[model samples]
Target: MNSATPLLEVEGLRKSFAGVHAVDNMSFSVAHNTITGVIGPNGSGKSTTIDCISGFQRPNAGRIRLDGRDITRLTPQKIAKAGLIRTFQTVHIYEAMTLRENLLQAARPFQASGWVADFLRLPGMRREVDAAMVRADELVDMIGLRKYYDAPTRILSYGQKKLVALAAGLMPKPRLLVLDEPVAGVNPTRIREIEEVILNLHAAGESFIIVEHNVEFVMRLCERVIVFVGGSKMTEGDPKSVQQDARVLEAYLGIPA
Candidate 1:
């Protein structure tokens, strides 16, 4: 690894569910302004590793760092505020809310006031709400959802739902985005659209660590690839090199390389 610190780093991470080790001693780092792909078979600990990094699940052992600060034990919301955001394999949006409303909710700052702000409707609250809407619209346009900005999210198609998920992830203007299967089960037409959005986001100085099973998608989008097998690091490198590695072939059930 280089001497410069990576935007996000995982070291010696270990986690288990009911005695099965989902992620065992895993370690990797994502550098600034770079796309790193994480690929593994079903149950190869790809999602489990993301869970630990995003603070959704606590690891039994390991260290996680963001910009050299240890965030191993922080809450998910706190981690997000620190500029590390994660997306789910399944899009989670407010079905009853309009696309604008859902995006506005994401733009709101973490309220130190919490329920107090809601109860009292403190001064300047309305202004803050307005600002959030403005930001929300800008993001909605950027994610190509402007046409449905006022439409209820429940009425959107699966591909549109995925687009909303990407919009929501960008609400906070995160430094690092952890995408969990951004293109899964979608038709080929929509897959291209999602891929374009991801590339545009990357071009705009946002780093990403994407967990995907689509080998072609992963190979094309990632500058570097990390392969995991049986919950541990198998091999990692540039696209052509990593693809030809013997261990990588064995891990993914490919013919001997």
Candidate 2:
């Protein structure tokens, strides 16, 4: 791939926790409008690398560039404002709120002033609330959760909750969406539905980096796969080629190639 313009680039990324290098000297570039899969065994630093890139965690050493702008030390909120967002493996939806309200809350803009202006129900606040509702509705439809929009999120199944969590992440309109085990614990029926929604979003001009332990499912959705082992990059290539690489298998299985 040409190096002139990449949507995202990481170089020499490293992170350590309790004397263990969770991520070590990893480097990769993601082209614009591409779906890249990140696969590795549990504790292989897959989530750590993503956290560093998305600003949930800072790397001990590395460079994170988006559209050629360095953002290594940016805060999570800053990263989101800059169009990078991530969804965790664990769900974060509000149990008491309806799916629509949850999405609406996520859609609201970041505001420093609190309580006083909101309590008064100012015109600007009302307008923002209305806009949030509209955006929430659109996202609900896109995620195929329109029927459950007004329902309490507590009543949704595990897979449905996962979908709603993903939709909530998109409410901020990120340029790159990083997902961590998006389909983990999901039922077989909803797995295909999730894939379809993700693919449709990709087709509509979104880039993604999916971190998953389920290699086969990721291979089906991603054009290229990057493998990590012992907190460093092992290999990366098209799914077919990467899967056939003896080194990749060794990395996943803890054996020599």
Using alpha carbons, what is the TM-score of model 2? Answer: 0.91
Off by over 4 Å in 1: 1-3, 110-123, 254-257
> Which runs in model 2 stand beyond 4 Å of their true positions?
1-3, 110-120, 254-257
Show the colliding residue pairs in model 2: none
lDDT of 2 by residue, 188-225 (tens): 77888888888988998888899988787899999989
Residue pairs with colliding backbones in model 1 are none
Q: What is the lDDT of residue 140 in candidate 1?
A: 78
Q: How close is candidate 1 to the true structure, as a TM-score?
A: 0.91
Please estimate how well model 2 matches the true structure, expressed as its whole-model Cα lDDT: 0.86
Clashes of each: 0, 0
